[model samples]
Target chain A: MSETAAPLAAPLFDRVAIVGVGLIGSSLARALTHYGVARQVVCADRSPEHCAKAMELGIVERATTDLAEALEGADLVVLATPVGAFAEVGEQLGPLLRPGMIVTDVGSVKQAVLRDVGPHIPDGVHLIPGHPVAGTEHSGPEAGFATLFQGRWCIVTPPPGANEGAVDKVVTMWRRIGSTVELMDANHHDRVLAITSHLPHLIAYTIVGTASDLEDDTKSEVIKFSAGGFRDFTRIAASDPVMWRDVFLNNREAVLEILQRFTEDLTALQRAIRWGEGEQLQDHFTKTRAIRRGIIDAKQA
Target chain B: MSETAAPLAAPLFDRVAIVGVGLIGSSLARALTHYGVARQVVCADRSPEHCAKAMELGIVERATTDLAEALEGADLVVLATPVGAFAEVGEQLGPLLRPGMIVTDVGSVKQAVLRDVGPHIPDGVHLIPGHPVAGTEHSGPEAGFATLFQGRWCIVTPPPGANEGAVDKVVTMWRRIGSTVELMDANHHDRVLAITSHLPHLIAYTIVGTASDLEDDTKSEVIKFSAGGFRDFTRIAASDPVMWRDVFLNNREAVLEILQRFTEDLTALQRAIRWGEGEQLQDHFTKTRAIRRGIIDAKQA
Candidate 1:
């Protein structure tokens, strides 16, 4: 018992199987290995190219297309695929998850993970859903880096009555890889991220879509002058399309709720602009500065 | 005349007067002096604090709160104040202009600048309105840098039948300070910026306002987890409130037009999310990525 307790204190997973090898998955594999959080980090991606790239990039010790093959001997499994793929992946993944193994995910929307992956988890296999609130516009295995999770917040949504040791181990891995972990309820996590991530991405996508449909000459000028502010939206809008789509679909209620609030607020400002309400516009704009200050103070900026 | 040719070839402004002495104003002063584009740089601001900072930073050879005092012996003048102040400042500025002096602006909206400042221009004085499609969220004189305009586009909209030599001098100044000059009409410049700059800013401000209004608990979490995407919007929304407020009031028509289109697009996306149209959302998201690629390829990213 003491010998077993000693290994648990180190919080090292003997094997970690990351199923995706895309940006987040590949980055996690790199971080787990680079930080010595796992004895071995293997990945299974549906795309052969991603598997090849993962191995070439040396982010994972071994990369394969076979999910079962990757799961063999793994004590921890991480689903890094888009949320839309979770149900199918979990259907196959549940049977393969060993009783003592821990299954977690890196999807942006959390409640959907619980809804999609919860039933598949074997009774003894612990399930924890998480979102590492960090990313770049770039994607795929080659874009992954060992320090991708450094100084970011990783929110974990563990099932009610789940194994405490399993939850602690998952949190430990994230912290070890340079993430701050926050334990949260899946529903609350989805709601928080809806405002923080989903709504922002949806707005970015909408504005960019509108800009792209402009006349050819106007379009070129728009691209040329984008540095003013549009460039930032473009970068955010350029994030993984499938991933973002899944996020909006899975987090529909919370996203739609926040977006409805956003539209109402936008309409008020629009009316103010049309009516030449300068002071009103100024007051509203001034209020937002405090939020940015809070973010900077929180060191998230 | 041949002796004056040497100075003209240098593309230098002698005794330049910059109004406002804020972010864009101070940055222009720094660039003018740092790149030897101006023989002497002086600035005037309504706030004496900004003038003091401008002089303390050595960004200008002279700084004063008196616009008339700053314009003495100046061959060139730049109206860097917010567009809302253009008419009032132009009234004060028009009488101070000399016959040979060329006046330009670094305002975001060009047509409004032309309208507000154009009527006040004395005969033989060139009024070439310009917009350097660049800035940070930071404001005030001290938040500026010499290279703020470097590798950026400075769109100049010279009035019809404008003085060729004066236009050339303004264009040359922008080029010498490391901006690529695009000669555009004021109407077109305003329309283009309506989408690229104004609408994006309005959306950012609105979203940040919405997020800021969330219940205090969720508001704190939003800021803490903002790195996902909200942080970018906050940075943009953190821009000077008065300046942005003035922009919306001045560029009302163009901004409202683009904003109408943006709202329609956002509604379509909202409907798509409601109906769980994954493919539609994915396609829309994918198309926006092309615009980002265009921006990157154009090196405006």
Candidate 2:
């Protein structure tokens, strides 16, 4: 047992398969290989162009369109695809997984992953869902870098009674790639992310869309003057449409709940503006400033 | 006359008084002194600490809490105070201004600046309301830098039939300090900024405020996991509370108009999310991506 543990402590996986080669997937591929955590990194992307780019970028040792082909001899399979496709992908991936293999995902919404991918895990295969709370507005294979996950938080949501070794291995990989790992319940992950990620993206998308529909002259001016704050929203709104759509759809309950709270707060502020209630407006704005200080103190700003 | 023309083409003002010595005010003071556009930069701020800091920082040659004292011997008076304070400041400075003195402002809301400061302008004084569409989230006198206005757009809205020489001097000063000056109507400036600046700030303040009110455990987690999106909002919402509160109050009509549109659009998106309209959300998200590309192409990103 000690002899077997020696190699297990070395490279975590001999062959690792990333099932999607987008921003997060490509970043992981580069990081795993750069850290020597995976001996061989393979990519399976539905987009042939992404697969080609992944290979050309040298982030993956091999690229394939077939999930089964990518899974062959792989000890770890990472579902990096959109959350909406997770259930279907899990259905296809269950039959191909080996008993000792581990299946992990990089979805933003965690609860949906448990509901969608939990049933498909084979009797002996371990499943751990995670979200690395980091991203730029850019997407696609070429947009990723090896250091993308550095200093970021990666939350791992492991189902009850799951293999302890499997959970530790996944956590070790994230930490090796320079992420601070946190073990959280899937439900709590979804709720927290709804406020932090999902609601912000939704608001960004809404505001940008509203600005885009302005008169042609006004639209041009909006772009010209965007440094005023709208520019930041535009960058957030520019994130991958399909990915964000899946995030909102998959985490509807938490997102909608938080969003309802947001709408009420916004309405109160709006009324304050209409009534020229300077005190009310100033009070709210003052309270929000403390949060930014907290974020700076926490070293997240 | 030729000898006078030589220096006339040199420093624009013999004594420039900057009221309110805050971020924009202090930055302009630095720029004016750095570019030798003003012979002496004097500051008048309600906050004695800011006045002392402005003088200590060497952005101003002298600082005073007395507006009349600072404006003495000043040929140019820049109202750098919040719009909410503009009317009161203007009323006090109106009788003290000498003939040929130019009165300009760096207010966010142009129409309100004109409405408040216009009536107080003496016959020889020029009231050219301007908004330099640039700033960082930081505030106060020390936060100002010489290059704050570099490559940014400055919209100058001179009331109809205003003094051409006054307008030209203000425009030339901005251009010398590296701003691209554009002549726009005060109404148009207010409307455009409502979408680009005011609404975005309001939304950011609301979202960050919402997150700040979360349960202590979740609030800490939100900060820890902020790289997802909430961090951007926090930065914007961290802006000076009094300045933003005044902006919303002064430009209530225009801000309310754009905000009404934004709310309706947000509601539509919210309904889409409720019904799981993935395609609709995706389409809106994709369209907004084009706006970011437009901003990049415009070199405003």
Candidate 3:
């Protein structure tokens, strides 16, 4: 059935406060408006320029630097800032939240969200941490689009014994915004993301780093010839610096764990090459090809 | 000046033979026809179906399975087959080559080409090994297009003491086909490609393999959630299996050398992650970002 065929119930929340007006935050605001998922959308950004631009773009009904002012009269509040700022934002919003209100976030790292944002969510104020598992290399308010979440996965991790209604409402909101919602524990979410996103970003950044360190002439040639394999790494490395910094800081455990495994595998492959073990190299390559096929069969490729 | 501004003084060869009508071979055939670089383009492939399709698609003037027959009367012969088959094809074509004939190839690994085919080249024949650093994920005759080489580098590694005129003519042909030509020793070309191309492919294949070994449910989720990072690996892994196998087999030395460096770097990153070395991770990531910027500045990103 078409997504819009869902019963046209009254807007889920009276006012939705989006705390941050960057790419992910702004995209959420746009999708919420496009789907009429909330009665009103207000935004809070540390950057006054971003707040002004978001308001000018008409993505949110109101934009402000005052977090409490934006949260006033809002039934749903989304902490859309970088993970590094979540604890402070959570503490600031905690005092202002009413009994029936719900709090959540769209951060890349989930366990850190629970640890940082959970304490500030007062009793009877439900908290559902979520990650939409989607984005482009671009950032900022202007980079967001209404369909940013379309056909993507939105993972929600509500603490045990938390309000089911609150989780369902958040899931429904993501569905309205054209996302498939999956419920996962926050720790599991961190591990999965470490492999699927964090490690990839790290490797891309490293290879690009290696290239950057080359001498001027060689470096220029590296870029000129980047279309071979390096271009893809460049795209991944182009992601928002502050946001990624926060991700690494928050999800330290899982990212590190998977990174260890990746390193071991990489080392083994290296030895095979150094030792001129053609069979080992070919065997590994052949095995990897099967994984690619699996991904294609799953419609991911 | 427009590429078509200059007309050829005369045809370089009466008939140009291309053995193996895959993406690269068929593409060369198309470019030869489009630019009138050759008098007639003849193709041969081990797959009868490919030969038939090449003829049906009009990618070449004639298609055949008999390598010796295809080499007849051809002043220029291009070995478009995988690197693994070069020795066999070289031996067959060596005796049939008339004086003043030029034999070149479109292979990824240059040193291997010299090792396998250099000895077979008769005294009067010229052997210029070229690699056009361009391709899509697709393969086979039907996947060929004339513009594949446009704005791409085509490295020509002519053996030392080889005919300078022959090298010039091969370079001219590549330039006319819309490729930027660079001359380097075959060994150096192999080393550069090992870092830029071969090692990246190996890593991609390995990571995808690791994902494939995950539990069934996790594997499915991986594919579903692949867009975040895994999609790029899938594209690389989907490349022609036989061609890649041949590449690994032929360029064993250089590919192995670079693979070692990549592994060492990967291991260091892994240890940092396992030990929660956030600063080290951040430093590496920051360094990599500079490379990405370099690529962009060079217009390769």
Query: Candidate 3 on B205-252: residue-level lDDT in tens?
Result: 766766666677777777777888877876786677667767877777
Count steric clashes of candidate 1. Answer: 0
Sorted by lDDT (best first), the order is 2, 1, 3
The candidate with the higher DockQ, 1 or 3, is 1
**lDDT score for residue B234 of model 1:** 94
Q: Residue by residue across B1-301, what tens digits does model 1's lDDT show?
A: 1222133445377799999888899899998887778889999999988988888898898899999899999999999998899999999998988899999999988888878898999898889888898889999998999999988889999989999998888888888888889999989988998998889899999999998898999999999899888899999999999999999998899999999999999999999999999999999999999999999999878
DockQ for model 2 equals 0.85
User: How many angstroms is residue A77 displaced in model 2 relative to the true structure, after the best TM-score fit?
Assistant: 0.6
As for TM-score, the candidate ahead, 2 or 3, is: 2
Model 2 lDDT tens row, A1-301: 1222133447888999999999999999999888778899999998899999998999999999999999999999999999999999999998998899999999999988888988998888999888898888989999999989988899999988879999988998898888889999999999999998999999999999999999999999999989899999999999999999999999999999999999999999999999989999999999998999999999988
Rank ordering of all candidates by DockQ, starting from the highest: 2, 1, 3
What TM-score quantifies how close candidate 1 is to the native fold?
0.94
Deviating ranges (above 4 Å) for candidate 2:
A1-9, B1-9
| DockQ of all candidate complexes | 0.84, 0.85, 0.50
lDDT of 2 by residue, B187-284 (tens): 99999999999999999999998998899999999998888899999999999999999999999999999999999999988898899999999999
lDDT of 1 at A117: 92
Docking category of candidate 1 = high
Candidate lDDT (C-alpha), each: 0.90, 0.91, 0.81
